[model samples]
Target: MTRSDLNNWLIDLSEINSIYIFSGSEGLWFLISVVAFVWFILAIYRVEKNDHTSIEEELSNPEDLKNLIIEINSDEVDKNNSN
Candidate 1:
């Protein structure tokens, strides 16, 4: 209701637990951050391991190159229409 009431409520809430120990919400956030970081690193490693071919090698076939160009043009047209 009042600012002082809100401040006192916050102070009481903080005082309920010691700052040195991780609260449940803090621990959950830390776990999520660690998992996300590890997942990102693994994804990068997996991509590097699986992707052995260069761009030139991938598009060496004429048909593949033509299809890629057509796909790009279609995507561009769709984007332009959206705007």
Candidate 2:
């Protein structure tokens, strides 16, 4: 069949909705972007809907949590010598 006939047979102009399939690395990127978008939306939804511990109740100790703890004199340093 000719190119014109093939085109006409493949795509119908009367259809209200058209679906296209993407291929190759460009398609991979599109898929990745869609996943990332969904992930971000889910994260936002969870944050807004989930209940979390309050700041005052959560952080009672200054150096308790691994991530929140600060480096406080691991080695014995001269605290008396101010010079």
Candidate 3:
């Protein structure tokens, strides 16, 4: 479609100020989009919160770091022995 047709379509959409004006499929899709957006935002928030808590716990316990380093070194040694 031409730019004018696209512009007119956008203008028409802008005139629709309420969800009730949408047809069945349009309303369903709009609701689905809103729900998906909220879910995405919540998921991101939860991930960030979990990461901060995990970091704080790791910092509070030095032994975890040492254990992690030991595991890494052991894995490297096993790889070297295999090679």
lDDT of each: 0.75, 0.57, 0.75
Ranking by TM-score: 3, 1, 2
Tell me how many residue pairs clash in candidate 3: 0
Q: For each candidate, give its TM-score against the true structure.
A: 0.36, 0.32, 0.43
Model 1, 1-83: lDDT tens digits are 43232334346575464443333466788899999999999999888766755676889999999999999999999999999
Q: Whole-model lDDT for model 1 versus the true structure?
A: 0.75
lDDT of 2 by residue, 1-83 (tens): 33222345466656624334332356688899999999999998787655454553576665555445433342224454543
State which candidate, 2 or 3, has the greater lDDT.
3
Model 2 compared with the native: what TM-score?
Answer: 0.32
Q: Distance from true position, residue 28, model 3, in Å?
A: 0.5
Where model 3 places Cα greater than 4 Å from the true spot, the runs are 1-24, 61-83
Which candidate number maximizes TM-score? 3
Candidate 3's TM-score: 0.43
